[model samples]
Structure formats: structure tokens, C-alpha cells
Target: MRRSTLFLVAFFSLFILLNSDTRPDSTDTSKSVTQEKVLSHSDKTTTETEHHGAAPSPYMVIPFLLLLLLIAIAPLFFQHFWEHNYHRIAIFLGLIVTTYYATVLNDFVSLKHTLVEYLSFIALLSSLFVASGGILIKVDKKATPIVNTLFLLFGAVISNVIGTTGASMLLIRPFMRMNKDRIKSYHIIFFIFVVSNAGGALTPIGDPPLFLGFLKGVPFFWVVEQVWLIWIIAIALILAIFFMLDMNNKAGAKEDQQYSGKIEFKGLKNLGYLAIIIVSVFLDPAVMSWVPSLDPLPVGIREIIMFGVVFAAYKTADKNVLKANEFDFGPIKEVAYLFVGIFFTMIPALRVIADLAKENSDVFTSSLFYWATGALSSFLDNAPTYLNFMSAAMGKFGFDLNGGAAQTQLFLQNPDAIQYLTAISVGAVFFGAMTYIGNGPNFMVKSIAESAGVRVPTFIEYIIKYSLPILLPVYAVIWFFFFRG
Candidate 1:
């Protein structure tokens, strides 16, 4: 507890220092369009612009690479040290990059922007984590191939309504409990593939990248309209594979064991909290002009409401339900610590990639866009990758990224631009399953499963055994069928 308190203090202190100079230079209106690109469009007055300095040095990306290496191998090589010290390691690496930006480049705008994103990310995740933790779903049915497949299919469909993170938090426990007799790493892996990634492709509210797209002027239903077919194909193929794998598992309840074949739900009121969190997701000024923006603070009314849900849900939660779910803060704590480092260290890498994409925008096609966005989003944050590629694609036809809703509408009117946008959307959402760090929920789900005593694969093992073998082929099929032009 002392260590946790200290860690929180250190984090907020650093955040305060980083935002001490939140005043944007109104006189700097002559900056290039790249420099002027708005990091967060929700707040008109306090929007974070891209760093207005010379492009970041490519060598500045070393810290990010090192962190990734540590994340991938440390648990396998030195489990004790990694478990106890990971927070320190993540924060240290993050501070290294934060110092470089503040002292060397004197660029606080980018830091503030990344910090805001981190807050928003953590707020939503923690709220959903707490709220879902309060609700316990128990399935007493026999675990059969068809039943498991239907369970995954239901998770896939509802993911479009509640968002990937929400759906993942809400269903993972029940799914695991249902398969307790034969739960394996592959079960969790397939959950990540379908529910946490590709399943969210059908709605803007389903994923952060698509939500950003909606804020930039895409219609609310544009995602479902454009990618419904792709979503069906990807989900169906993955579920089919999962079904085949489940058939081989000989583990099951004993022949004489009885089953209730009923579904039990508890802590019903937390569903209201869940509903509040979902509704608060759209309370951004960019989405609704009446929503107030809390500029310079990085968080807004939505985040405030989410953090409140985190508190209220926990306080009102039934003790029995919490115990049944084995609810604890372990998973969220790990994600919050590690992702702070990722969000900070990857800033230079994102800026570099954005520059390269812009420089070669004219030569890029939908296929190239698909591959490039997928490759980077597999490791980096997918939301910004989606935005960067969308910007570059728009620039291909001479549209400003900061041109807001009207400009985005114009860009979409072009038939070719529609193709590029479709590819970018699918690639960003689908490829997020390629790695644990690819999306916020992937790591959280892995942690939850690990805490439940399921033997999860190592990070490298996950890629080598599961993702590379399963997801890559499916994604290739998607590209061939949809983005081949």
C-alpha cells in the first residue's frame, strides 16, 4: 500500500510538472499543417497541437524498443524481478523520454497531449474494470464446441454496442468460468482475437480509433455500413478455427457430473454504472457541442464521470459477487503502469512514421495503407496510427488533417479515398490482436486470465504460437478480398 501510494504521488507530480506550461502559443499561427495537427479535437480552446520543433531524432526511439524488449522477455528470464519492479521500470523509461522532450527539444505540448490520452485511456479502462468486476455471470452449461462457439459469437456481436474494452471486461470472466473444466490459453487467446479486437470493427463506439474517426466527421453508422461484411468474415473465420480447436480438447466434466444448464447473474445495479460509463463516452465536446470541455487539464467531463463510476461501483458492489469474480486491482494496475511508458516512449516512433507516411503519401495505395497501418498498430497505439494514416491519405488528395468535419466529409466523397479509409479502419482494429500491447484490453485480459491461474503464453510465445499462426492468415485474407485494389 505504501508503494502504491508513492507510485501514485510520483505519477501525479510528474504530470503536474509536465502541464505547468499549458498555454499554447496563439502567435504561432504560421506553423506548418503537420505542426498544427490537433492532437485532441474535443477541446477547441485547449487542443494539443503536434510538437512544433524539428522532427524528432530517430535514435530517440531506442527507449521504446528497450521497453518492448523488457516486456517481452523479462517475465520469462527473471520473473521475480520483473513482477516486483515492472512499475519502476516502466515509469523510469517514461521519464527518460519525458525528460528528453522537456529539456532537449523543450516540447511540452506533445507530452501534455500524450498524458491526456493516457488519462483518458486509463479512466475508461479502470471504470469498466471496476464496474464489470462487480457483476458476476455464471454459466452452468456443459462446455461443448458449439456452445463455446456461440458464446464467442455473442461476445463478438455485443462488442459493437458496448465497445471492445467494455465487452471484454463484461464477458471474459463468465466465458472462463463456463470453460473451467477445460479452459486453456487458447480459449483466452481466441477471446482476445474476436471480442477484444476484430469484433469491435462494426461500430465507431466499438474502438478508440473508430471513435476518433467519428469525431473527425465520419457518420456514426459509417463503420457498420462500411465494414459489416469484413467484420462478419473475420469473426466467422476465427470462430470456426476456435471451434475446431475446442473439438480436440479431451478435458471435460466427468461423465457422471451433473449440470444445471443455467446462467446466473449478480450485482444487477452495476449494470447501471456500466450504462453510465458507456453514455459518458460520447459526452465529449467534439461529439456533442453542448458538452463542456475542461481544457489544459487533459481530462474532461466524461473522464470525471468514469472515475466516479470506478468509485461508486466498488463501494456499492456486493461482497459475494466481488469474491466470486476474484476481483482485484492487479490487472488494471499492471496496464496503467506499463502503458504510461508505452504511450510516452512511442511518441517519437509515431512522429517519425507520420512523417514518412506524409512524405510518401502520393505513392501510397490502399494495400500499402493496409499493411503499414496494420504493422505499426500491431505494436504502437492503434488510435493514433489510424489517425496518422487517415491524415496522410487525405493529404494524398490535398486535404488538411485539421480541417475538421467538413474537410473529412469532402475527403470521403472521393471513391478512392473511401477505399483507403476502409482499409485503414479494418487494419487498425483487426491487427490490434497481433500483440498484447496492440490494444489496451489485450494486456488486461491476459492479466485477468493469469491471475485466475490459467497458464498464459509468454509474450513472444503468444506471437509465435497463436497470433502469427492464426491471425496473420485471416488478416491476409481480409486484405486480399477487400483492399486488393
Candidate 2:
């Protein structure tokens, strides 16, 4: 705790010294866009926006790095404290970061935007958790290598609809159950690669980071068009590798007790609730345009609808169904706490990256953006990391992504900027498979696999043995074929 406190103090002291000059200059105006229009379109903003286009000093990004470092190291070194008190650690850092943004910088507009983004982010994740938890799929099938590969294929496709978390939760157990008699650690590892991370590249609804992109003004269908080919190639190569690996492994004797029922889906009503959530996300912006008086009505309405769906699912679904799924609030709560800090501390990093991208546009080609975003995403949570790179790309092009339809149009029209955007999106989603902490579902899948008596690899073991050898080569192929000019 004391170390965390001292780190916060050092972070803020450095930030204060770096950003001593707070006043905007003449160049700030020309580069900065219309703040009112930007605010009117996004979340939790007052009618004020600032176009301080002078590149932010890089030292101001220390807090963001500190937050990422804590997230990476805390679980490894202080498991008990991190598991039990992650929220407290997150709150401590979040408070200091928020105070810095609100008081020292007096830039509450951007801060509010970040806060709103966090809220929308948690709301969507929680709603998916609740809705998907209610629906349970029970399968009674033998675990052949072909069956296992096909199930993974199904999960990879369903990930775009039910989300990586939802699809992972809904299927991991069934896959584990079928393969219980002949399980290998590699089975769980491949599941994480295909279902938990790479599968989510196709759509905004597929992953938390992509959903963040959707909320930030990227069109709902943009990811599909941009990432579909990469998604196909990645998933195909992963499934093929898993099949080969399974073929080489020797199977143990079958379990004495076998499940003897047809494939069943309990709490089916949650599917309807899930559909409602998807439709609300898709229609939020377009609906908001129809109601002129309600300038910032969509986020609130979407959030309300999301919460309502959660409530309805909780009330309608049986307690036994949730118990069967081992549904709990720990994951969602962790995401909420940590992301609040990430969203706030990332302000300067995003601003600086954008400024650098604009001035040194040649430095940010498609391949460089791909590897940079993918490497960071492999260790840190991919959502904020995705937003950071997107902000940089937007900065490179000298425009805010907050200008909903107009910004989308601008991106579609600019081929170079679109290439960077596509590379960032693909890298953020695919490389999340490199480590357990990279995506929300990776650890969850690992936990579920362990509870079912599969001895999963330790963090380093998993990355070095499985990810580096298998996944890295596949990603290299993606870069060579798609991102290389």
C-alpha cells in the first residue's frame, strides 16, 4: 500500500512539473476542433470542449504506464492482496488521477468524457455477463479431436454475437465436460486462443475494446469489413493447429460417469435479452439524432436499457442456472475499478500519441501500428489500449473521432488513416491471446479449465510454451500477408 501511495505521489509530481504551462496557444485553435459539437455527440460531457492541439509532454503519460504496470505485476507478486484488494488499489489510483485531471489541468470536459466511456464500458460488460450467465448449454458428446475442433469453430463464430466473455462462459464448461476423459492443457490453451480473443475480431459486439470503438464513433459494421479476412485466416490457422496437436496427444481412459442427455439450453429467455442489448447498441446513435432536444440521451437510454435487460434476466432466469454457470460479480467489478484509472490516466498519452502521429505521420505505418498495439495488448487490458491507439490515429489525421457520422465518413474516405485504424483493431483483438491477462475471457477460461481438473500452465509457461511457439507464428503470418506493404 505504501509503495502504491509513493508511486502515485511521484507520478503526480512529475506530471505537475511537466504540464506547468496550462494555457492554450494560437496553434491550439487551428488544430483543435469545435468542442461543443464534439461534446454534444459523446458521453458525460458539459457543453465545453478544448482544442489545445499543442502536443502534450510525454512525461504526463507516466500514470498510465504505472496503472498498466500495477495491473501486470500485482497478481504475480501479491496474489492475495491483488485478488482481494484490487478494487481498493484501483480506487486509490483512480482518485489521484481524477483529481489531477479535474484540479491541476482543470480539463473536466475530457475527464467527464473518459468517465462516461468507463460507465458505458462497464454497463455493456455487466449486461452481457448477466444475460449470458442465465443461459446454460449442456452437451453429452464424446471428445473426439474433430468434435473439439468443430466446437471451437462454433464458439469463434458465436463470439461476435454473444461476445467473447459470453461465448466463452457459455461453452468452456461444455467443451471441458465432453473432453473430461482425455483433457490436455493445450485444449484449454487453444480454447483461449480461438474463443476468448481471436474470435472477437469480427464485430464491435465481439470484444470489449471493439465495443469501446463503437461507443467512440466508429460505425457498428466497420470492424466486420476491416477485420473479416484477418479473422478468417487467424481462426482457420488456429483450428488447424489445435487439430494437429490433439491428434498427436494420447488419450486416457473415459470417465466412469458420463452425461446422458441431449444438448440442452437452459434459461433461453436470456437470448431475447441479449438481442435487445445488441439492438439498443446498434440504434443508439441513429435514434438520438431523431430526438433533437435530447442531446446526450443515447448513452443514458442505452445504459438504462442495458441495466433493465440485466434486471429482467436476473428475475426471469433461475438461480440454479446461474449457479450451474458459476456466475459471480468479481470479474465485472474488477473491470469497473481498473478501467476507471486507465480511462483517466490515459488522457495525456492519447493526446501526445495523436500529436506525434500528426507531426510524424510516416512513423505510424500499418505494420508498425499493428505490432505496437498488439504487443501492449498482450500484457495490459486490450480495451483502453485500443482506445489509446485509436486516439493516436485520430490525432495523426488531425480530427476528433467524436464527430459521429462525419468522422466515420472522413475515415472511410482516407485510405491511409483507415489502414492504421484497421491494423490497430486487428492487433488489439488478435494478440490478446498471447497472455492470460490480455483479454477478459482468457483468465476466466483458464480458471474454468482448472476447476474442471485440467492443470493449466502458469503465466510464463503458457506464453513461452504455447503462445510464443503457436500463436506468434500465426500473427506473423497475418502481418506478412495483410499488414505488410
Candidate 3:
């Protein structure tokens, strides 16, 4: 984990240097911070909005973006001097940056007209939140290979309900406890594969991208329809791979580690928590908008909703449980911090891509476009990335807003919109496994596992070991056989 952190710092350092002029931080001499804030006439540092009406000068775009990137990452270097709740500084900075960028970038009018208001964004974040408690749990004594397999199954099953992170928090301690006697137990990696990533594919609530899809236009029950197929395929592959690997680990087998355990209904009985999740969704566009729908949530009800959740969580989850798992708000805070800068700084790229879609609609229709968008989405922000491709498809493919095909020249005269949408969706969701930043949960999973003392691979190492070797093949197989030729 430390190594991965170092690697990421280095990577971002390179990013800062290569895009030097665009860095947005406040310098010792320079009074202004690009995306972070701009001191207003009123003395309040306000959002550093981009020129969002239409296309700005091409020269302005790159320089402004570089300035924004610098502002975004500027905090990393200063924490050594001032260490009291410094992370919060980044969080607020992120909020300012994302807000400024989204508001100031080209075509705010179009974005406002099309996508739901800023409230929806907040709702989306709230909906994605999930967590659980974990105590040390040992496996059943005298258990065999079947026991290990069952443990994996149990954790995987819980993932969809409570989320990958939740299931990890709930079952990982016990999962590790059960296998504690073995010195070479690499079972934890398989746990991450099945319990963390694959398991989250079943429901919108299970992962952020899927949740984002549901909030957009994708149906709620669509994922449920594929439950068995996705789950079985993911689980089978993981089991087969893990079992084969375990068989090779003579050291683990040599230790006659006695283990015995039963399912704790605390995690299972809390199944009722899904109901709270449902209520939360209704609160999104359906109800929350009605309450104090006047001022922008950033300046109004957004704070109320944020406070509301904190109050509820404090009152609900047991203190011991929270403490045991060390349920700090760090992960979500990190999301809030990092993504704000990302959304703001990358508006240029997004607008550029959006313009590309507007100009060349055929690009969205081609198979090359689908895979390419998905592949790039593996590295970029999949949401805006998805939107860019979607916009292109909408303009060119000539489909209705529902993503249905146009009924003219052939079965579907213009298939660009739907094709692009599918490509973007699939790319954002599946290939996200390639890198940590692709999806919110990717790094969260790694950090959580490491917090539990697991040996997580470095950022580059993750791609080399797991993604390219294991995930890409499975995703490719699924894509070639089902999606494309």
C-alpha cells in the first residue's frame, strides 16, 4: 500500500510537471489559485468558473486546464508542515474546483437543460455510500477446501446487498481470521477479486458507475436480470483460479490450521438496510427536490442533507462496531476531494470530446469507438467520459433520448447513440478494473484491504498482475462473444 501510494504520488508528480503551466495551485508569489478559488470583490474566495457559454479560445483552454491541475494537486506537497485535519482542506478545495468548473465550463445552459440539477449529484453521492463492521473471526476448525470455497461464496453474496466495501468490512476480518494459521495464505487476493470487484456488479447500489447509470436512464431492475449470469461467471472464474493457486501453495496446506465458524446474522439480518437504500433513491429526484428547492444545494439544502445523514449514522450504527472497523469518513472524503479537481480541470477534455461527438457522429457508431471509449474510460473519469461519447452518439446516431434505434433506412437507421451509450457504459464499468482511479471503489477496496493488513499491489503492478492477466481476458471474452464480433 505504501509502495502504491509512492507510485501514485510519483505519477501525479509527473502529471503536474508535464502539464506544468496548467497547475491550479496558489503559489507563494502568485495570489490566485486557478480551480481552487478566486478572491471575489466581497473578499470571499468563490468558485473559479471556466468560460462555459460556448467554445473559449483554444489557447485559453489548455493553459486554464494546466493551471487547474496545478491547483488541484498543490495540497499534496504541504501536509508535512500543517497536519491538523489537512484532508478536509483538500475536500473543500475539491468541492470548490468541481463547482467552479461545472458552472463555468462551456454550455452550462445545455448541461442544466439536459442533466438534472446539482442536487442530483449530491443524491448520487449519498446513494453510493456503504459500510459495515468487522471483528476478528476465525474459520471453522477441521475445515477442508470446501470451507475456503464457502467463505469466498459468503463474502461474494453479501457484496451486492451491502456493497463491496461493506462486505469487505463485514467479512474480511473473519475471512482472514479463519485462514490465520497459514503463513502463505494468499487467499486474500482472491477475496478482493471476488468479494470486492466482481461481487459489486450485481446491482446499481453495488458500484458507483452502475448507480450513476441508474440515476441517468438505465433501468433499476436491469442489473437484477443478470444476477445469476454475472455472479456465476465471476464466482466460478475466481474459485477456479483461486483453487488452482491454493493447490500450488504447499505451505498453506502443510499447516493443519483448525477453523470453525458460523454465519453471523448481524451482517445478514441487516439485510433490511436495503430498504433504507430504496428510500434514499426516492429522496433523489422524486422528493428531495421539493424541499427548499430554491437556492442551489451547494449553498442551501445540500448542507441540510449532508447533516441529515451524519445525524442518522451517528444515531444508528453501534459505537463499538464503528470503532472496531475504524469507520472514518476518509474514503468518501477522498472522493469528494479528488473528484472535484478532476471534474473541474478536465472540463476542457470533456468539452473537446463533446465537440468531437457533435462534429463526427459516425465515430460513436463504429465498433472501434465503443472499445476505444471503454478502454480510455479505464483511465479517465468514466462518467463525463461516458457523457462525451453519449453526446456524440445522440447528435450523430439519430436516436431518441431513450437510446432506442432510429427506425428509418434499416432496422435502426442510426445506431450511433445506442452503440455509443453501450460502449461508454461497458467501458466505464468493466475496464474500470484496470486502474484504481477508473472507479471510486477501486482504490477504496485496496486501501480498506491494506488497512486490514493485506498486501495490495502497486498501481502499475495491479494492471500487470490482475487486470491485464485476469480481468481483460474475461471482459474481452464477454465483449467479443456477446457485444461485438
Candidate 4:
């Protein structure tokens, strides 16, 4: 516990040093349109009439539907020798379908914010490395009373900064290796609970929905500030549970086993790659500065820094060291492959929600959309699910009070349109913790755990066992007691 406190204090100090601008700056809310911009007109009659027209988003869905049909047939027609990892394929497709549904409903979100939010999420990985590396500096394999505790704290801290997946990837192996001799090690499960999910609540990169929220409206830093409270509580609970499990195993520990220090961390140069990830995530808005008319100079600068830094990292990383770490393209590749179809397939779902957004105002504020989307995201793809909810909420804004009838004009220009938008942003991001498959890193971590021979829960089994029993209940508490208020 003492070690955990020191590590957390160190992590905070490092976080402040790196993230010099972690402030909750508000967003630009006023809808400023001009003659230069072409826009559809609406009547200020009723809320329904205020719509710009039947959601003009059918164009986006046709491509997605066609693609799905092709995906279904391509494998059969090609007789491709490629191995089909059925579970992975199932989860990937689920995300695509959910995204498509959300897109059709107009619940989609933007891309700019996702980029920036993800950058910070990556940069934070450096801090995890540094902190974990610190413990290795003084590692005494013989007496690791504080190792599990240190890992749990480090996992949570990193979850906030680098994201749950990065933290888990960086720390999980070291954790298992440290306790290799112990026969009673249930630390892995607790590791998954804290290292993988519970701790990653604060920032958007910490969880995908949070990033989606940033894409939608919520300030980047606000999530970290407000979510720290939840992260801390979850961290504490996970640690306590892990301690109990470890203690039970310790009771049956072998007397002859001796401490061994086989694990050593080298390649400080690769540490720079971790930094590149952070810069990329934080400066996403700055990176997109060169897009035609919208020259967000900061985004341009950020993009340059990310590409330049990471490129340098790739050059400097030792092949031997990377091989030792077992760093493969598998995780990122899986994310890329699955998300390709997902990003396109879900446009229809988003468009549909965008069309119905004005009428479903209650869905946003009441958080039915948030919980529902997040829970489903646990098994589906979180990104598309997030976009779906965001698109729907934003659609509500397209309703023009002037286009509505005299009887319903008051509701169209209620001047409170932005509130619902923010609600979608808040709910979707905050609620992604309800299941494992909800986020990209969740399954990746589970796969890693299984590789370690940790006996991970099956997909539906995970939902019924870990998620439904633990996550859903706690999330319910957080919603009604913390978020709803």
C-alpha cells in the first residue's frame, strides 16, 4: 500500500510534467452560419417540422450494406486459405452491425476529437513504463510483498493516462512473471479487472467512448478531472479483491521456491515511441491543420510531431528488444481490420438517429442511450456504438425552430439544444465500462491473458460472469448516484 501511494504520487507528478495543458476548456457552441455556407432550411412550426428534411443520410448506408453482403460472400467464393478465428470474427462483425445501426439512426460522431483524445491516451503509456521500470530498478524477487499492489496502482494510473490496453500490455507480463513461482496466483484476474478496465475510466483514450465524447463535445481534460474519482474507487476495490485472492494462494505457496530476477527492461530508446503516442493523442486537433479551408494550425503541428517522433522511434527501436517484448503488429492490425468495415457500415445507424434526434431528446438526457450503447459495446465495437449515439444527439440540433409550425415553434428554438448533445457525449463515453468487448483493448487484453495461460472467460461467459455481476452493478451505482445527479 505504501509503495502504491508512492507510485501514484510519482505518476501524478509525471502526468503534470508531461500534460502541461490538462485543462477543461469549454467548446464553441453557438451555431454561426453565414451566406458563404450552403445549408438546408427548416420551418419553426413543430419540433418534427424543424428538421432539415427526412435525414439526408441514406447515401452513407448503401455502401455499408453492399460491403456487408460482399464480406459474407468473399470468403465462400475465394476459398481463401486464411484461418478464421471465429470469436474474433464474430466480435468484429458485431461492432460493424451496431455501428451501422447507430449510423442509420443518426447517432454517429466526428473524427477530429477521437484523434486528439487517442493521442493523450497513447502518450500516457510512457508514464506507465517509467513507473513500472522504477520498480524494476529496485526489484527484489525474493520479497515481492508490494509487487501486486504496485502493479494494481500502476495499472489504474496508466489506464487514466495511457489507456487500459497500453497499461495492461506494458505491465501484465511483468506481473505474471514476477509471481511465476507462486502456485496460488489469482493475481491475473484482478490484474484484468484493474489493469484492463476499472482504472481506464477517466480519459477518452482510457476508454473509446470517452474519446467519442471528446469528439462530440466534452472537454478533453474534464473527463480526466471528473473521472478520477471513479478510477480511484475502482482501483481501491480491485486492489482489495486482488489482495484477498493472492493471500489465499500464498497460504498454499511452496517453501522451496526461490526468487529469480530473470526479467530485465532495456531499450530506453523505445521509450520515445511511448512519448510519440502521447503527443499524437493530445494534439489530434492540431494535426489536422492542413485540411483545405480549415487550417487548424495546432492540429497540423501535432500531426508533424506524431509522425516525426514515431518515425524516429521505429528507426531507433532494436529489433532484438522488440522481439524479446513479443511486440507484434497483431493487436493494431486487428483493430485496423475490424474498424475498416465498422467505420463505413455504421453510417446508416448514425443517420437514422440523426433524423430522430429531436424526438428522442429524453433518450440522451435520461441516459438510456448511454447505458444501452455502452453495454452492447462491451461485446460489439465501442467506436461505432459511440458514433451512433453521438450522431443521434447531434441530429437534434439540425431541427430549426423557424421551420416548425406556429404551435410547435417554441420547442424548436428552445435554445437548449446543446445540452442534449453534451449528454450523448457524456453518457456514451462514461458507460463503456459495462463489458469487455465494448472497447478495442478489451479483447486484446483478454487474448493476451489467454496466451499467458490465465484461463480467460469466454465471450458470453465473460458477460454473464465478470461483466454482469461486477461491472453492470457498479455502473448502475455510478449512474444513478454519481452521473445522473
CA lDDT of each prediction against the hidden true structure: 0.87, 0.72, 0.49, 0.47
Q: What tens digits encode model 4's per-residue C-alpha lDDT throughout 1-485?
A: 24533543442343233234322112211223431121111000011112232344455565555544444444455424322442244334434443343445332122222222233333333333332222222233642446678767877777777777667767766666566566232455556667676677677767655654453335567656655665565567556655655656653236786556555666665555665565455443322323222222112344455455544554556666555545554544444344444443443444455445546745565356546555545444455455555445444555332221221233323434333333344445434444443455555565555555666554455556655776566567656654462
Instruction: State the lDDT of candidate 2 residue by residue for 1-485, as single tens digits.
Output: 45654654554454344344334334334433654334333322311122343334577677777777776677678878877776566666666666666567666445554555555666676787788878888787767788889999999999998788778877888888777778889989999999988998888889877876776667878889888888889999999999998888778445575546479888888889888887766544333544222333324567778888878888888899888877776556556556656766666775665455446655777898899889878865577667667766776777665454467567666888778889999999999999876777776677667666789887777889999999999999999998886
Stretches of model 3 off by over 4 angstroms after superposition: 1-52, 56-131, 134-159, 162-171, 181-193, 223-235, 251-257, 265-274, 286-295, 299-307, 400-423
TM-score of 1: 0.95
- Candidate with top lDDT is 1
Query: Candidate order by lDDT, highest to lowest?
Result: 1, 2, 3, 4
lDDT of 1 by residue, 1-485 (tens): 36855975687677677777755654356545653444344533222333345567888899999999999999999989999988888888888888888889877777877888888889999999999999998889898999999999999898888889989999999999889989999999999999999999988888999988888888888889889998999999999999999999999888898889989999989999989998999988777777766776768899999999999999999999999888899899899999988999998988898888888999889999999999999999998899889988999999966666888899999999999999999999999999999999999999899888899899999999999999999999999999996
- How does candidate 4 score on lDDT? 0.47
Which sections of candidate 4 miss by over 4 Å? 1-146, 182-189, 215-217, 250-253, 256-264, 286-315, 350-358, 363-370, 380-436, 483-485
Error of 2 at 204 (Å): 2.8
Q: Name the lDDT of candidate 1.
A: 0.87
Candidate 3 or 4, higher lDDT?
A: 3
Tell me how far the alpha carbon of residue 183 in candidate 2 is from the true structure, in angstroms, after superposition.
3.2
Which run of 10 residues does model 3 get worst, by summed lDDT?
40-49
